[model samples]
Target: MLARTLGALLCAGLLVGAAQARDYRYSDAHLHYVDFFQETEGMPALLEAMDKAGIEQSMISGIPVAKKWHEDEPKRPRYYAGDDADAYWYSATDSYVAAAVEKLPPEQRKRFHPFLSGINPVDKNAVAHIERMLELHPGLWQGIGEVFTRHDDLTALTSGDTPRANNEAMTRIYHLAAERDLPVLLHSNITSKRERNPLYLAEIEEPLRNHPHTRFIWAHAGSSMEIHRHQEKMDFLLPTLTRLLEDYPNLYVDLSWSVLQPYLLDDKGTPRKAWLALVERFPERFMLGSDVVGRFSSLGEQFQGFAPFLDALPEDIAHKVARDNFLAVLPKPR
Candidate 1:
């Protein structure tokens, strides 16, 4: 009897392992190829992480701003938020991404979709900079952002005028994205940490309304790690997204890990029904991302964490959210 009980437990453990194994592939919809310090683990590390994570493809871009190593600081800060040092727009970041991907063999190179993001979103000349990048590497850039606008603490730390999604500079950038057939992944927060309502909603909404032709992937569905840290939840996010989806056809959402907890999944990590319904209503508009900046160790866990939520979704919709949606948003050949 004891032997039979042990055998039953072994079979149950095997079944659990099989259940936990991921069967679907993933296309990381948002990833920073370089960190605020303008560094990465290199392509070998990234490819290895992706291979382990089951990420077949990725949308790779550089952080537009570089954190300054303030002179007064005794120790160099490891991350952007480590100190009050100002970060400035660094155009060389795009080149870093290009260099890394270009060095890869053709097969490996094809796995990455590089986006140009090394521009100050508040600078009107930013669009011109993007144009130059496209000309420099004819068929290289696949999309436009992870453009930092209205980001949490980064807004305060970034040098120069604050960037808004509806600003003239970003407006011009949006037009360029539409013209070039490149989807723009914008990181415009919906609200500040203190406020509950979508206070900054208009910033993104204006662009969505005005630039109907440009595909805009609202990174983290307008939520940020900083904001999530401060507030329990943005109670208004779901309805706001539903309304936005109903109104704008070109809008897409990146389900990065920041959005997974307390919104899509509850405290116990169970998928929330309202959020599931929202995805079900607009299956083609959602995609998953690791949102890992310059580090790859957490890539597998970042994606695998979504398994509970993805499993709750319908099979077809789950597949689209996991991989197909991101590919669908990529720029088409001319």
Candidate 2:
């Protein structure tokens, strides 16, 4: 009787291990590790959430701009499109814009800078911290990612009076990324005919026109504008997804925070089909992004929002979106 009981337990353990092995690579391409969440909660909190969700890794992007989120319209970052495409919006405040100007030597300051909303002062301490984080917790970034621009920053820089400031800023960040070989996951939404979003499109289109080596994963299926929209989100998103994937190969899309996300589903809502269909079209060309906004006010809601979305996905596709696809892009598993 004792031997039989032990044998039964052993079999159950083996089955559980096998089931876990059968699971696909679970990754989340877009995550916010920044001011609101980072200072208080930090990356460990995010990792805990991942463990529960069975997320093996995540392309965690910290906010590029600290306080400078594109808080306004016309001056909003050009990298964002849709209704404000024609509108002149700034992603951050005017005073905040001057900070990046400080990064350049006096002589070099003549050329306009690029960034959607604002810039982060290169903190020797923070870079040291980033380095420490890597050294102390080697493989901490098995799937961590570039935080890219906060939404507000993208607005201001892209809406600049100058032509290529936003592109130039991206190039600067891209240069840094190329140096570290970290595939930073920036955010962009393409709906507007003009503004920083279109400017962002031009920034990459012109440079990568022939190179074909440049690759970027568009977060949120290029619908950052839909975050606030209730009924009209699909109206704004579907067409954009089709247009973007058709154009950029070095480009991929992540169906982050889509209207079809599971939690968003309730009684009358059924955006899942459209979301799945979009993923079906570009199964290989997409990843997952969960740009859960983390401000003091919204922190509670932002906490662990992506877990449910992960649970909601079919195992196979969810595995790809969550982990495997991102690994294909990383230079080394940090």
Candidate 3:
């Protein structure tokens, strides 16, 4: 009878401990304040959602490019790339993000770390535009990108311009980012959605090798929504990530919602042993993100989705991935 009572108490304690783990607050390393389709609920709503979701901090940026409408389509796309022909650089989006952040109370504003996303990655004048924006904002912008290069489907649609991670234009931007002490969150998909091979790996590798000083947060760990929808699993993801993390000290992985399934969690929604081991090995190098575009209603849900993965991590490492890692990477205040 005494043993049974003791076992019950132990079970209760374990449950309480699990609950505490799930309550871990997060610093969302990747999220968009605005998107091409103008689907956002705006700043006030986002703050409310962040508060509700226990997101203490976030890296906010506007989509640097806009998806063009395809007139031939029988039905308009709810999303930018649904049936859109191409994506084009639109600098005004950055102003919208800046304006929203500026309106927040100083306390609330501090939670938002804004990144400059207005410059076209392939444009010859990309560096000039970045300099101009930095001068204009005067410490308002904290980092650069969500810069799209080698994006699935979108890359093919990117009319006339072919943006590459190692392009001269991007190299110039990397140099400037190093000088300014800003991290660059680049979205260079490692491969096309249909192809399992890391075809575009060179595009990102060159930049990592060339600009060792510039911190590069590889968005979705080089995965995309299309990849998630089409492929049950990326056989190459774990090995590729292991190599990149081992190779590039400056490279960080953004394990956003897109790569959650098959990569981080198995079919049963439990954390994969390999992924947990990877995080354990390089806790500081991995960060979580909702990758929510202009929507606050789902913010809490998006954050909660990582609870299982977080619970499985060592306490200190979980805390770092949830919050500290991102804060550690942010540019020091001027």
Top-scoring candidate (TM-score): 1
Q: Which stretches of candidate 2 lie over 4 Å from their true place?
A: 1-25, 36-38, 68-166, 172-181, 192-211, 225-231, 234-236, 258-274, 293-315, 332-334
lDDT of 2 by residue, 211-275 (tens): 34545665554445443343243353455456656766666766565533432343354435555
TM-score for each predicted model, relative to the true structure? 0.95, 0.54, 0.93
What's the true lDDT of residue 135 in model 3? Answer: 92
In terms of lDDT, model 3 sits at 0.87
Please provide, for model 3 over 186-259, each residue's C-alpha lDDT reduced to its tens digit, 9 standing for 90 to 100: 99988877777888889999999999999999999998878777775778878988998999999998989988
- Tell me how far the alpha carbon of residue 92 in candidate 2 is from the true structure, in angstroms, after superposition: 18
Q: In every candidate, how many clashes are there? A: 0, 38, 1
The lDDT for every candidate, in the order shown, is 0.93, 0.45, 0.87
Q: 131-193 in candidate 1: lDDT tens per residue?
A: 999999999999998899999988999999989999999989988898889999999999999
* CA error at residue 197 for candidate 1, angstroms: 1.1
